[model samples]
Target chain A: MMDVADLVERARRGHPRAVARLISLVEDASPELREVMAALAPHTGRARVIGLTGSPGVGKSTTTAMLVRALRGQGRRVGVLAVDPSSPFTGGALLGDRVRMQDHATDDGVFIRSMASRGHLGGLAWATPQALRVLDAAGCEVILVETVGVGQAEVDIAGLADTTLVLVAPGMGDSIQAAKAGILEIADVFVVNKADREGAQSTVRDLRNMVALATRDWKPAIVPTVAARNEGADDLVQALDKHQAWLEESGELQRRRLARVRDEIEAIALTSLRVDLRDDGRLDTLADRVLAGSLDPYTAADELLA
Target chain B: MMDVADLVERARRGHPRAVARLISLVEDASPELREVMAALAPHTGRARVIGLTGSPGVGKSTTTAMLVRALRGQGRRVGVLAVDPSSPFTGGALLGDRVRMQDHATDDGVFIRSMASRGHLGGLAWATPQALRVLDAAGCEVILVETVGVGQAEVDIAGLADTTLVLVAPGMGDSIQAAKAGILEIADVFVVNKADREGAQSTVRDLRNMVALATRDWKPAIVPTVAARNEGADDLVQALDKHQAWLEESGELQRRRLARVRDEIEAIALTSLRVDLRDDGRLDTLADRVLAGSLDPYTAADELLA
Candidate 1:
């Protein structure tokens, strides 16, 4: 086994094997995780994180591939995290999608990983940010975190990125409506993928109205693209650049990064506490009393904490 | 304002206003929440919780109403918690759904409330179980928790129920495919809603195939229903009853309830701890160091906890 510090050092030099191993350590919550994180900490927070999210059929994977291609064209080292918060039951579904991403398989400049939450639902919440740190410290200039689904978990994961791109394909029935209102708030750029489709203009108009309704300093830009043919990739990249520029000028970038770190710290602490509560015999005893109606959950919680 | 004990006492008598008030307290996370929960504790553990989940536009609301009607015909008092875990951006969207539920407005035996998570993501996790406790103590024989979206949050909420009905409608693509596999494991029964639609039979066949793939002590039963016309509701009801019987006979009921209580306690304890971390100035200091790359999040989390 390689030493944690030595592994982090190799990762910092952009060794793909070292990067993959570090991410595995994060995923497994390995015993040396604390040392690994401390070793990598000083090198992180440099990569620009962009989150892409939409419903399943909205061409998120295609758009992601297009963006990765565009970023590589710009001579940038990129990392892609395709996070699936769905059941681990359909692991093959995501693997099939990853195979299509083989467009970058021969390109050493790009690193792509697909992650699915296994066992406990909290596992995703606990592991994703740590994985992001691995990519960031490994000297990736740009990291695209693309997550499946349009639910609250998607919104929560989108919050981890520096910029969030919300994708909506045409004829997907008010794709934004299916996306829920939270996605609108977090959207730094709206990509109307499959823009060659019939309802593309209408989807764009609807998103414009929704954006107009929200009050914020940086109005989210909507970029239309047919990601399958890589159409409008340049426009999407320009939109991303503009958003990053705005983030820096408005001083929101620092603020957002700080908030993200704050949340990551809090989630880690809470997860550790949750694991303790799970392992402790006292929780079972308290749950028994609550189940028996001799104690309320809140009182039981207080007792457990005490 | 009525005393907490008096409110709980009235709720036990199935007073509509009292029950509504108690639920409001849970939603607001009111100062008297702990007291209200303590007062209501002993009366809980009686209601049968049924969770209904499906993708958007799949007739979950309609199926839920139909089941409520059938259960009412059986002379049982019911409570419905329509939980929307979407962004509070479209409050009116769920309100519109709730207005349709006004069909049972005149019936004193029914209590329906629509809860949209406001502010934080953790808000829903902390509030839903307590709200269940409120309905459980208010003499509701069966409480139906109908949640919007087909994400992990829905799965988590479904875990709180005694029996979970996964709804799938025809012509909705592979409706169950869109629903993550975690949903399948949690489902006690599957309702092929919109059975009158063209593809209903095929949908049922697909579900049976999926169910056959998973080996469990109890294979989930798939029932077809046209909930809009209130067709096949009796079969749905029968399926639920049989599942409940199995739950009780196989000792799964006790185990499920115990696990639910254990989760409830853990969530409560973690939520309290989160509130503390949010308010304390130390977290901000830790976040700053993390942002500066002077410390990693895991180490910073340890410091915050210390």
Candidate 2:
């Protein structure tokens, strides 16, 4: 078996198997995996992480696939991290979204991985960003992070991404009503996917009106696309590029990257604490007591700390 | 100006102001409010909490309101707790759903309050069940918990309720596709809301098929309804009653309630630990060090525990 450090080294050298192995290690949260992540941290931070989120059935997976192909066609290496909800019964993901992008499965320029949400509360699994870092250090220029879009987790994905695309479909009732709060605010660019639908124009109109209501500073452009058919993908890519340009030219890119770094640090801190609590015998004892009626949970927790 | 103990006493005696104030204090996670929850704990475990969840636009709020009215009509005092997502910009909620059920606002038999998600990852906000306890202790016979119908939070809400109703609307794409994993297993009863829509029959068919596929000894029932018209509500209520009867007949009600109480205690303990970490000046230092890269977050967290 390849040791985690060796796997990390190979991943940093762009070995696909090594990259997959490293991600598995992180997701498993094995104590041994920490050394590898620590070693890889120095090599990370080169790739731009973009989060793609939308309500389910909005073709986020298809859009992600199109973006990967588009970027790969432009001679840029791309990585896609698709986060699927964990199956409560099997403790595995039912849909491996990476399989949907099988067209590029053999393409060396693109690397696609599907991650289970693993019952983690905040959108991506705990190891997701860490896996993205591995992909980043493995020579990917653009990493797309796709979340199983459920409100706050979607927002959390946006927070992680340098650029966020909030996807929406037409005819989803009152388009504004379907759009959760803060989703409209986070989009660097909004893509009305499945634009061939009847209500496509109305969806765009609704989006424009809502965006106009929200943003006072820089206006985000809405792009229409049929991602499944690959229609308007080039235009979508151009829009993304324009948004990136604005971020760079306006110096928001640096600020966003700084925020990402700050968030990453906080995430790591919380993960560490969680791991410690998981490993400590005291937590188990507290859990048992709390599960039993003998102790009030809050007081028991305080006692554990004390 | 009311003390927590006095507030608990007043709330237990059915004072609306005291109940509302107690919920606010608990939801705020204020240091001083812990005493309020503790004081109210002993008087809880009386109300039957039912969670209502579904995709957006399924009229979950409307269904919840109807249920509240139905329960009140039976001469059972009811409480409605609507969980809205916290505004990402303001870190507060608009609490607009209260207006949707305004008819019951002035009814002494019904008490309705909206609680913000407060950045809590899951639907069962850490403070939510505690707030429910307050209502339970305040003499509510049935408590309705409504969430912003997404996926995981929906599941969390389901798990927290004595009985969970997964609402679905007609013609909303593939019913099976919409029935995500966590939801299928958690929903005790499937409600096909908006029965007036075109695909209601097919949705019911899909739900029945899905339930048949499940291995559980007790299969959940599919009930169709147009909540806005109050059509089929009596049947829905009858289905709920049948399920409750089953629980009672099998002695599962007591078992489930016990398990829930245990889970609540454990959750409370974990939350209290988080609060302690935040309050004891440990988290600040840990955060600073992790941000500065002076300490690895994992190690810093370990040290704090040590």
Candidate 3:
């Protein structure tokens, strides 16, 4: 096996190959992942995690590319974990999206990797935070986690992010759909992409009205942008910086980070316990009893835990 | 404080109120859940669970209502659990969706309940199977679990169902979107709703082309329907019956059931362990250590398990 310490050293120096390799270990759940995480742990908790999410066709890739460009313009290193959909149709389209981000490919300060949201259960849940830790340790000042679709996965991205931007397009019913998906509540900033289109004003108005209804300590800022044209990119970056400042000033950043790590530890612990139960044949035995109608699952679980 | 035995008995007798109460306990994660599950265990495994999922605005509600009508027409007792999105916009829309199912509301043979996918992590994961158990033991011959949205939640529903039907609409980009969300692989049957619409044939053809690409033991059946007009309801039901027969003959039913129960047991065990670790203060100490960089999360997890 390649030396994990050497990889960590190289990653800390902003070596893209080293960072990508570390994340690959995470995504593959490699045997060396535990070592890699240990080496990366002390270097983390520095990167600002910004999550970008919306339904497909809201120009998430375009917005992400624009944000990367703006962040790089500030002379700060950046990383992006674009959580791509693993469908044959879109799976093939991921290359097209990547081509858009090639503007940063030669820049050592920018690291972009796409993690496929495969069909396996908890795959993203297990891999995402670890990948984030890799980027954070590699000295990326800001790590953008962009995910497609508006459902539980989007909510999950919110939980991982320090500032979450919910993207919507004009006249796509995206505002109402975001509201219905509960994506509105989790957003720290709302980006009205394709803003030059008709109905953009109405979409923004609807979002503002909904935002007005909720009394939060920080009201999510609404910014309109035509991502394809790179309009409002500066405003979007400013909005993100403002949220970052508020997060620190209000002490919400530390709290959110602590809570995030707490969840991570709990998730890891639970997964370990589950693996032990399954590998030991205890789970199968209990499951057989439950399937035979001889015992309840709760009681069987209690027994396994005991 | 209600007697668990009495509640289970009433539920077994097809008392909708009792069934609802039991499910409420499940949803609430009540302290007496163990007793309730024990009481209901013997009566489960009889109801064939059918999960219908698709992107929003694809006529899931209408198709579900139509399916309830068709299932009821056969004189089989039915239960419908509509997992609604908990958003202000769609929260209100759920009432309208419920009104459509009111066609069978007054019928004692049909039980309908809507569960909210609230902003809680693992809320649906922990509660859904328990609710299905309640419906199953209540003498419902078939239980339909309908979920709105196409993401991880939809995949979770597929895991819980004996047969999963993925709905798509003509010209809605539902085909590509469904494929992108990876909803295609989880489906046992594909419903092309709104078949009278202009792009219906192409939608069906697209689904067939994708379906043919995968090499599975059982290929998903594609059925076109105008659910609002109640057209193709019989064919959908027949398709479901055919899949059910194949599941039994191919021995996939037992295998799927075993896997489902195994997952259920593992989830319960993990949840119970998480609660134990959290309540005992061990998790806090470990998380704090990990946060302080004194230890990595994986090592801390191992310590807690040890």
Chain A of model 3, TM-score against the native? 0.93
Per-residue alpha-carbon lDDT of candidate 3 for residues A162-245, written as tens digits (9 for 90 to 100): 999989888866437536437556889999999999999998988888788766798999999998999999999999999999
Give the distance in Å from residue A93's predicted Cα in candidate 1 to where it truly belongs.
Answer: 5.4
List per-candidate RMSD values in Å. 2.2, 4.4, 2.5
TM-score winner between 1 and 3, please give it: 1
Model no. 1, DockQ: 0.54
Model 3 misplaced stretches (Cα beyond 4 Å) = A85-96, A117-122, A150-155, A173-181, B85-95, B117-122, B151-155, B172-174, B177-184
**Candidate 2, pairs of clashing residues:** none
TM-score of candidate 1 restricted to chain B? 0.95
Give lDDT tens digits, candidate 2, residues A1-306.
557777778888888888887777666666665577567655666788888877667888888888887898899999988766453321222264656888898988788887764545333435666677678879999999887653454336766788888888897634346343566668888899999999999889887887778744567779999998989889988988888888789888767765555445445555555545555567656545433434455675466546
Residue pairs with colliding backbones in model 3 are none
Q: Pick by lDDT: which candidate is best? A: 1
Tell me each candidate's TM-score.
0.95, 0.84, 0.94
Interface RMSD of 3: 3.8
lDDT values of the candidates? 0.82, 0.70, 0.81
